[model samples]
Target chain A: MAVDHNVFITEESIEGETAGPLAGRTIAVKDNLSTAGVRTTCGSEMLADYVPPYDATAVTRVTDAGATIVGKANMDEFGMGTTTETSAFGPTRNPADPERVPGGSSGGSAAAVAAGEADLALGSDTGGSVRCPAAFCGVVGIKPTYGLVSRYGLVAYANSLEQIGPIANTVEDAATLLDVIAGPDPHDGTTREAGADSDYAAAADGDVDGMTIGVVTELFDGADERVVETVEAAIADLEARGAETVEVSLPSLEYAVQAYYVIAMSEASSNLARFDGVRYGHRGESDGNWNESFAETREAFGAEVKRRILLGTYALSAGYHDAYYAKAQDARAWIKADFDDAFESVDAIASPTMPVLPFELGESLDDPLRMYLADANTTPVNLANLPAISVPAGTADGLPVGLQLVGPAFGEETIVRAASAVEDAL
Target chain B: MSETPESDADTADTAAAAAAAVDAEEVRHVAELARVNLADDEVDRFAEEFADILDSFAALDEVPETERDEDLINVMRADEVREGLTQEEALANAAETEDGFFKGPKVS
Candidate 1:
């Protein structure tokens, strides 16, 4: 069970005996989730010693279905960074290339599956957290429609934008894991009351024949030439399999990253406010008045976490709310409209999961904008509240590329179908 | 993947304009509102970094406004009592507890 990827923050075995579809499978869970008596560090010093009092709904569901809980995986502190470098424990090295990053904040989950440390893993994607890492590590990751999975025990970063997803070696395995962890939860009111159950495993059997796949031209606009070429070749393989292809555009995509960050940060500012060192978070040494101790505790957050909390606070501040938060909501509505129009003409849309190959460890650490820009292709899915899957498409210069298949809201079946085709062709 | 889109020029212009909107003082103020105290050096660093990030976000300004739908209802189920966590379980993870309650700093 020892994988040198540094994927898990805490590696311990928990037994599960209820026989179900995922029987005998091992699952690596991101540390941000609540697991009773297990340390959920969330890749931050703020909760280094904190253990949850109860299990996350997803964890309970999977363990109830006979999946063993392997360990708590590392992540970007509170899921804020594009690279796992922000982890307070240590950055997870890409199983494919140690010198490069395993895309984050679900970097450890992807690395765990890619390195064979775990049979399947749970990752939460707010923007591109799950898919980006899956792309870099050459695995399949699914970000179900916004409310498809219950977020009851997932620690909040951006409540409206995040969902717990599956990362697995194969699409079938991913679907199996999804079936176990996904369903409506009374604890999380945001979860959809119905339409949560789907036989994703069955959906993976269909061919892409007669399916109209739209290539997202915007996704290719600024990607590396080799990466683009490799993805196009994958598309050509799909064409050879009898699928029709057409070029499509989501012009509002030009503004997705910006809008996503603004809304995410704003929500983060409010969600993170609860971590004041009083109840469960890390408490400070000083025994002074409540305010000073609270301030000292907040100072323990990682740099990226601080950056997001500060920026978010700025955006939601009185004089700026109209210019930033409101505008971002408008942009979100526009992006959703664009997706509705695109779906009218095409069954699904395809894009390169990320613009470039996984970069070096410290390449974009200091340039926050560059890290934010890398999420362009993936963020629109969150804004539009649709289902998307990232399957290993091809390799450019040895690093794996991911082909993203996006379908309409609650259209997991269509995305799973197209992704399975690409997964087989590649 | 590192290539900039055709709108790079416009992005640069927005960055330049937005940079002036955030300063060290603004960063410090926001940090205070969030209940975090930033060291003087952090204030300066965050000020410059946030300006760049905010500039990127300004692209939302180009979004046209749309009419809000009035039919959106707060998705709520019938309010009924359900099985829930006990007080002991809720306070089990607290750093300090007294009289079956989470202990905290004394309020003024």
Candidate 2:
């Protein structure tokens, strides 16, 4: 089989021992996840030749469950861009439409599953990375509640806001992958003790009878008309299957994108400091002083990464700290409050996964802010630290539109149940 | 605590001033702090980009402060020792290694 998509940087098939939950399943792990003896570049030239010495927790869990490791998938450079175009290896083409992007930074994981290169794939979601690609590629992906999956072996990028998630061809498959990977690790201190052993596969009954779903108005504002209509029709189909729908307002969502970028970039600035030339990846041949050598070596970073680091440094600077970072924290809290209030009246909130359809390659690369705004609908879910799933709702023209279902913290079961219904509808 | 706040006009002016605050000099300063080298043209490009990006983030100014930070608590683990990467494994990916240690440029 010709693998046309620029999906995998390294390819191998290591089958697990027989008789486990993921027996015989093939999975492609995003390159950011450490694979023992495999080159995990994370789509950055700085680590183009770097190979990890150990496997991440998620990798261990899946392999132990009998899933065959297929390869290391591509991603945005250090998971910085909305499109995989920033990948030093090259952009991953959308399996659905090769001309357009496979929304990133987990685009390769989604494309791998969509193209049948892998039965399921592992991807990380730092502010919609996994879900956005899943939406654009017409697959199912879930960003589990923060701390549900251990981050021990995954390379850090905006650590506080990211979780390793599963991308699969169906809701059940995604949940099954989640079951194999979701748990607490002594190594990753932030992982909680709940939902580690929950049987997520059992939640895919596809029955949303009497379940109340909230339609977020702010998420609908400024969204493409076709995308809104497609999502609305999907909800109506859910309502026809005995689900109640209500219009809910998360007024603070207007500020969520801003808050998400500030917080993510700030955390990224600190987390990425360990990439100095002495420790890992590429080292420059500079004979200058230590500071100059370090700075010169860091020049290998791509444009988007540099922009974010600079912006993050600015936000966390002394005089502007209270004005930018502090305000973002307050906005995050308010958005979380809004979700908490909405969940009381509804089982889960629903919105269009992405505010717009997938654009062509290099279309939004020139203006970074325009690309950031495309994440408005999805960032709120990450900010609130809730579980969410993106399922293919319907099609706009020939492109796929994803309908997202977000639930209360540790509420992956609710999200899976509702998304399963959406899966059936589309 | 009951003192009157700024008027809407004043807030608008303040927002505009804050939006324009990220100039080329600020971009250079931040790049230095981040320890990432950028060329002169790149600094000018980033300064323009920062102006637009930061302006969009100004929406956070209107959001009221909440008590979320109070809810955050550091989770403590038992002081039990666990197996970690060995010396060889830790240094496996390093670019320049000396006798059992990673080497870097000499500090002046």
- Interface Cα root-mean-square deviation for all models: 5.1, 3.8
CA lDDT, every model vs. true structure: 0.86, 0.89
lDDT of candidate 1? 0.86
lDDT of 1 at A407: 93
As a whole number from 0 to 100, the lDDT of residue A326 in candidate 1 is 81
Clashes (candidate 2): 0
TM-score of 2: 0.96
Share of native interface contacts recovered by each model: 0.57, 0.78
Model 2 Cα lDDT, one tens digit per residue, B1-108: 112222321233333345567667667778888999999999888878988988888777788979875456688868887887899999999988999999989998
Indicate the DockQ of the complex predicted as candidate 2.
Answer: 0.46
lDDT of 1 at A370: 95
Error of 2 at A400 (Å): 0.6
Chain A TM-score across all models, in listed order: 0.98, 0.99
Best by TM-score: 2
